[model samples]
Target: MHIMEGFLPSPWWQVWFLVSLPFIIIGLYQINKLVQEKREALPLLAVAGAFVFVLSSLKLPSFNGSCSHPTGTGLGAVLFGPCIAAVLGLIVLVFQAVFLAHGGITTLGANVFSMGIAGPAVAYLIYKVGTRAGANTYATVFVAAALADLATYVVTSVQLALAFPGTAGFLGAFSAFAAIFAVTQVPLAIIEGAVIMLVFKYIVQLKPEILTRLNLLSESTIKKLQEAAA
Candidate 1:
């Protein structure tokens, strides 16, 4: 999913970077505000970021010899909120670019917007909506994570198509990539959803207090447990 340097023409790539700069700055500022408000969550965010970085480097075989890995943005967003996750994602991309050359510098802005911003934002929204509709914690996390992964790929496909508009314009190229990518991504989404559920289940069991502090455990459930303990 990471776009390579020189994959697209220089002029268009430069335009993308310039256009995405403001949004990146805004996202970073939001992350700073979140850190100020919830200093305790900073360590957790770092841990999540590291986890994502490592996971992202691991490439699983996919169709046509292409490979993919878990973005882990959904998990981060659900835990620390979308803004923080977006910032963390930028950090992850920077590291990957310098060390692994997974994504290029020229296309960093586009990559961040697609994989970092869009994934976490979509996941957080879905989680919030699902929770508000009375979905269970596991269900909310799983569905949100899955949808977030799907959204990331969708955005990436669109970016690729736009970057390489030829005889086929944006929509035509997008449709071609989307059709191929979606097949692999759909199953990837399900795997991510299950992984999130499993990780969350263990986290709740091992350190229930953290869940309360994070506001992830439902208030109603917490109250019932407190009453039972008393």
Candidate 2:
């Protein structure tokens, strides 16, 4: 859901930067705290970042000559919370913009706000609520990941709608943009969710203790999940 470089004009770009700045600041702090307090989680953090970078870089063709791809932020959001996932997403976005030219530096703020902040926030919230409600762990993860992917595009559509409402106005523009994104995004989101769920399931089976240590999943919950999976 990269908005491309120079696509957003004038005040709109600046507005997005202003909107995304606080999350960046908070994300920085969260990353620092995570590093200091949970040194052992470094490898997993790297994996999460790599997941985002690789998946988001795929760039499949979409409507209106735009492109779509999996955000891949759900795993990190689930593991470390949305703030830390934002930091990972920022890093991925920067790298893609610089090297791949996949997205633009000018639109970095908007892109981050959508894919990093908004998407991960939704995933983190869904995960928390789902787990607390005693939903199946894998199903909760799947829904979180899928919805996070969709949420990124939803925010992107909003950003686009606000920037260029044209004659149709905000609501009309929003509907148009959202429809274009949904054409490809829905199936991609489902695939992303399934992939994330499988990865998380692997982690759950291999290192349930790590999840418990992070307080993301309890020992008893893990046990129940394993039993159910079996």
Candidate 3:
């Protein structure tokens, strides 16, 4: 649900833009810190960003004019952490805004804050919490991805409701969009989660070395991997 440039009233949009500027700046600073700390993952981040761009570009048929696309933030956050995912998302959204016109320039700040920042952040939190609770990797990935996708829609709905208060109150708008979007998003989330889990499983099998370098697959998991490989 990308908000067009002039969707909101001029005065309100201007105020929202001004309020969102600090978040953009903070996001950029966090991105810079991530780059400095995780230089090795830069190439991976680029690759992941490219993947997200391509994946999001492919629109699946959905309700009315609204279409759904895969949000690759969950996989990225799980693998590289949310800081990098947030930066990757920002880059992807910016490119899409300029080239594809999927989202708008004036609404870029709100878009980035909602889809890029909130999605990955919530996904990472869910994944972490699930893992801590002794959930299986696949389950954690699935739940986190689903929640992340839902969270983005919720955030987008809120933005839209704020922009067009005549439609409904914030909660009402949020619930309406969530219900509409969930039809497409829920299935997509399941598909994405399965794909991510399978891909992770294969990568661990083919190049366990990469997992070790990333400090992802634990020693116990490595043992299980070797057993499975055998």
Per-model TM-score versus the true fold: 0.85, 0.91, 0.81
By TM-score rank, best first, the candidates go 2, 1, 3
What does candidate 3's lDDT look like per residue over 45-135, in tens digits? Answer: 6898898888778864444454567676777777677766766777888899889887877777677767777788888898778868877
- Each model's total of backbone clashes: 0, 0, 0
Against the hidden true structure, what lDDT does model 1 obtain? 0.79
Candidate 1, position 164, lDDT = 74
Task: Please write out the lDDT profile of model 1 over residues 70-174, one tens digit for every residue.
Answer: 788778788777767777888899889999988888788778878888889999998889878877677788888888889988988888888776688888999
Whichever of 2 and 3 has more lDDT, that candidate is 2
lDDT of each: 0.79, 0.87, 0.72
Q: For candidate 2, write residues 1-230 as lDDT tens digits.
A: 78899999998999998998998899888777877987866777888798778877776445445456677887788888888888888889999899888779889999999988999999999999998998888899999999999999999999999999999999999999999888868987887888789988988888898898888887888898788788
Per lDDT, the best of the predicted structures is: 2
Which candidate leads in TM-score?
A: 2
- Consecutive 10-residue window with the lowest summed lDDT within model 2: 59-68
Point out where model 2 deviates above 4 Å. 40-44, 58-68
> Candidate 2, clashing residue pairs?
none
- Superposition TM-score, candidate 3 onto the true structure: 0.81
